[model samples]
Target chain A: MSTDTAEKYHKHTPAPIDCNNVVISLRNIRKSFGSLEVLKGVDLDVCKGENVVVLGRSGSGKSVLIKIIAALLRPDEGTVRVLGKEIDQLDARELQELRSKIGFSFQGSALYDGMTVRANLEFPLVRNQRKLTRQEVDKAIRQVLDDVGLSRTIDQMPAELSGGQKKRIGIARTLILHPEIMLYDEPTAGLDPVTSVEINDLINDVQQRYNTSAVIITHDLTCAKATGERLVILSEGKFLRQGSFEEVFHNDDPIIKDFYNYNFISDS
Target chain B: MKVFFLRIYDIYQFSLRFWKEAFLPPYEYKEVFNQFFEVGIKSLSIISLTGFITGLVFTKQSRSSLAEFGATSWLPSLMAIALLRALAPLVTALIIAGKVGSNIGAEIGSMRVTEQIEAMEVSSTNPFKFLVVSRVLATTCIVPVLAIYMGFIGLLGAFVNVYNNEQTSFVSFFQEAFMKITFLDLFTLVLKSAIYGYTIGMAGCFNGYYADQGTVGVGRAANTAVVVSMFLIFIEEMLIVTLINTYR
Candidate 1:
């Protein structure tokens, strides 16, 4: 770590957290693909009902970090505890059971193109909770569609839906399971400003309504500012700045200043 | 060389996993049935056309040669031997390796690129059971049925040509054909068709499930599936023919 990065890390490192409230806790998490080290000794804590936005440019290990939390990808070295369970030690069945408590929303929406919106939502619900009657399944699907404001698109295939609508459906599919921790990978990416704001609002609504801790991964400052209660800027493989959105962005560091200028100026 | 060996190892592991997961409980019966319809019922028209044309053309082409030798009456038996032994199964396998193999590759490759497979995983649905095992099982079970259907259709086509040329009755032609065919030939046809189907399915699914790099990768996967399935089908055909011939 550079002198500037080390100082910033020491200065902004989070204080000890209450184990009861922390839904996800990672200490010294490290991951590498081939010889390319993507994450180097990363640490993070996501408290219950807290929204932590990880801000980073492309290829900066934002997605990898979240995948680690979801146990979709294992870390090479570190302790990962999600929902009070040690992620690295879980067997296949245990990991699956743990995964049921977390939802991952991919950037592309990842809706099954062959399935209609209703079937897509019912997929997770029916698979994880198999005892639900047909009426109960229909009710759950309807409720989630309503939550995402896409109730009318219940019978339509993903190909018929617009990009923003697909993203909404993707979130609805994840939310249908009522996961305790929601990992949103670039939730507002590739959406119009208006639609992005709507998604941001939906994220906040989910946080309040479901009392779910979430990790929002994005480089979009507007989304981070709107949805995140706490923000951390990841550069290279470490969190170089951490605090509230304004606190992290308003810094003397050249990298932070450049990122802020680039986003705002480019948008204008 | 190292990458090639690693890929071979990966495919071995993938095949082993499929065998292990396929027999596990909570099978995706609905998806498997859907794949049967997709792989079998949908390919009926093409298979019928090819089978009929193959029988009619091969019989007509062989008639003149047999006539020159004063053995034209043996045409029915010769046609039966060729179709039942090799033509029907080989043609059906090649056709399916081109059609269904590519379809499976592209569909699964697109899903991988779009993250639908991972989505299935996060939804607590075992994607291997739902997607890979279902399709593989459908192909393995359904291709033989199609091949048998093709063989009968080919016989009808041969009868049509024989009737046109020699005014031979359908009953007599069929009797002559059946006289030359034995139980082992039937067994070989079914066995060859099943092996080819399994090869096609495994090739398509393995390439597709591992596809990456986006749309270009999907196209590559589809192409590789067809090529690899066809190649394996030919090799398997040769090996099975040699093995069965030893018994004969």
Candidate 2:
């Protein structure tokens, strides 16, 4: 989205990429519910083993974009390809298999409150990997919990876990499947500053450990700075600017400058 | 009218989808059993209590009318037929429509509002099998048994109410109650109970699974589920009755 005076903002927008190495790709994605357009011909790609953060205001449709990659929502126009498979071309079973390779952490964590931590962690494997033995299941659970540092919460329910712990357990459950692409929706939205940083670190840690390509959707500047290898700002249902944090943060676009200035004020 | 038809079509498709998924591999019997225990076994106290009260009041009311006609001896047969052919199943289903229907609605509705259902789908699990099929199948399986139990319990209540003064024996009471139930009557009643059970389960699951995303939406779903299921029960029973009457 280039305007006559928007040269600085447009300068940092990403260049075109070779499609073969892309882990997730969207082309001219246009979606609308009723008369409101959410994504207007937006195109993005996440390379293998890279973290891209999408920053947007509330109601800017960041969550919808995240959902599109996971095939949780379909765009009225354009294409979504994840893990090299065209999403709309797959049948139900094939789509499910594709979904298993992608882990989505929702805004509220969305852990199954009916189940305990162990059951929540075990749910994906039990439902999908039916051939896993009991010992194997237990080992997988232990390994993931140990990885997330939540081993003792095995018997506890989601209601009992604090917000930070719930988010971790949510990630743990998704991680149990060893997904190749992780979609994080507001991973650090509601936590205190310290816990938010911790979750941000955890996101980075999980990305490196699992070798996952991730799309982190958040408004938290600290999170965007910490976890994102690349950042794209969504405004007016389009990618307004893209670059590293330093590049976009220092650029003199009025909209970009005002966003950083306001958030920086809030931070202090 | 169009919206009503669309809603009906949606429910029909949902039921068919459940049937399709139910017979496939990876059937979740544990989930089915849990829902059965929740929808049927757990509802016994309410069903039994209603059965007793219905039988008592029904027999007493019929006796008063029969006494005026000098036909009080017909009490046992009349009550027996009414309870077996209609009361037992209808009452049990209505109770379910209120208790279990609302519960199913709330459970699924809350999950939908909270995004647990979406998470399950994204995790590659079929929530239809884990959630809807089990609830629907459980009701279809367990409701008929519950209706039969209710019929027997109603008879016990009638016998207790008829005894001491009228002096009807336990053996005679059951004998008369059951003997009057012809095969056609039995079939119709069982068929009606099964249909009622399916309607209640489908209504609840449909409303719950399709509920909009909010706390208010959950409440609306539960309320709407009970009302719609009760309305369908009455309509279905009327249709079944008219068909049976014409057949006779």
Candidate 3:
């Protein structure tokens, strides 16, 4: 049964948060699966053009938080608002329209396996963007391919691409929509260190080039350090800390320090 | 009994969701056509082959029974009625339930495990339209046509049986067979096949879309899809026969 706690406001926030200019807002967000509570009264606010990286060990509900932001999963309690609109209030059409302005990039790229790279890039535009002419569709496809530096592989099927190439195409598919908010789930996961750095750098480039605000959930410190200006370490279902990268990186908290040190928890 | 009732209620809700989403705007026309080709044209050869074998076996078996009463001349009329009104349609639907049902279930279940379906939803694409609706509508439209094709091919198989018995003329055999058949028989034939089509489509997608287990879960979905759809086809045929018997 759903708890119907969607209207509950934050009761134990450490400090008052400024909500003005916030693109994504979660107030007392709580989610549980059976007996295990993955998120317990989590609160966060991401503003325009800001990149907030959520750091966590495996199974810390980092991915769940990102899914909730997209309204893909509803919280058992508390309110979620994306782009200033309450997620629970939007109708199906309104939700789709809202989603068009936001992009979600999954770790495996989640590219449609049956589609070629050209078709994968064309999917969102063909599905949602009705005003784009043929020329515009081609232009958008070419631009995003160029942005991801995968223009040569446009005609290649997703199966033909390498792990890093798939992730790049995954990001590029999201970028083609020119989303105002990008929700990335472990963009650098399952890649070599050099490729991981390349992807992290590419994410920074997309932020500048597309002027989009982003929420990245990762356990990799190198990925977090490279892409995140501000960082929030999630542990035991609460925000352990949130501040500029240097502020969280150098803090003396043992738990926060462990999150940084044990970044490869999921590697095994 | 309790678990069975619960399953029935769950399927009812699942079917209701499909109907509600089906009527919504932003339908995927291209995807629907693609599904038609996948469900219809791809299924023809197998359906035809099955239909032919079924007609030959049933006609040969029935001839031996009629010979006991020296009523062998009634063979063509009886063969046509049985094949057209029941056997061909039901058998064709059962085959489709096996082939198409398992396919939809496995495909969607794999997509679920891979998070492709979740990705589609997050990207604001109505996967219900692109995946479920296209496939369901294709089956609904195509299965009835396949059933009709099965009936026609089975008649040819019966003609071969009649030739073995010295009836010898194709034209005379077809004329005699169709003479006793009524429009009501044909109507019920089409109606039953369409219902069977709808059942397979719904059962396949319902099992697949809700599959939560990993790879093993996908296998369970495919298995359950074929089993449930085949059972539904039998239930529908029984209902159709009862209705026809009651009114006619």
- TM-score list, all predictions: 0.95, 0.94, 0.93
* Candidates, ranked, lDDT: 1, 2, 3
Write candidate 1's Cα lDDT for B104-168 as tens digits: 99999999999999888877678988889999999999899999989988988899999998999
How many Å off is the CA of A246 in candidate 2? 0.9
DockQ of 1: 0.70
Query: Which stretches in model 2 have alpha-carbon errors above 4 Å?
Result: A1-20, A266-268
TM-score of chain B of 2: 0.96
Q: Rank the candidate models, highest TM-score first.
A: 1, 2, 3
The stretch of ten residues in a row with the least summed lDDT in candidate 3 chain A is: A1-10
Q: Candidate 1 — what's its lDDT?
A: 0.89
lDDT tens digits, residues B1-248, model 2? 99989987997799899889989978889899999899888999998999988888898878878899988777777888998888998998899999999999999999998899999999999998899999998888888888988988888788888885589888887777777778887788788889988888888889999999599999999999899999999999999999998986
lDDT of 3 by residue, B127-233 (tens): 87788888888888888899889988898888899898865699999898999899998988888888898899888898988888799989999999999999888
Q: At residue B200, what lDDT does model 3 achieve?
A: 91
DockQ of candidate 3? 0.69
Candidate 1 chain A: 10-residue stretch with minimal lDDT = A1-10
Clash count for each candidate, listed in order shown: 0, 0, 0
- Indicate the docking level reached by candidate 3: medium
For candidate 1, give the lDDT of residue A253. Answer: 92
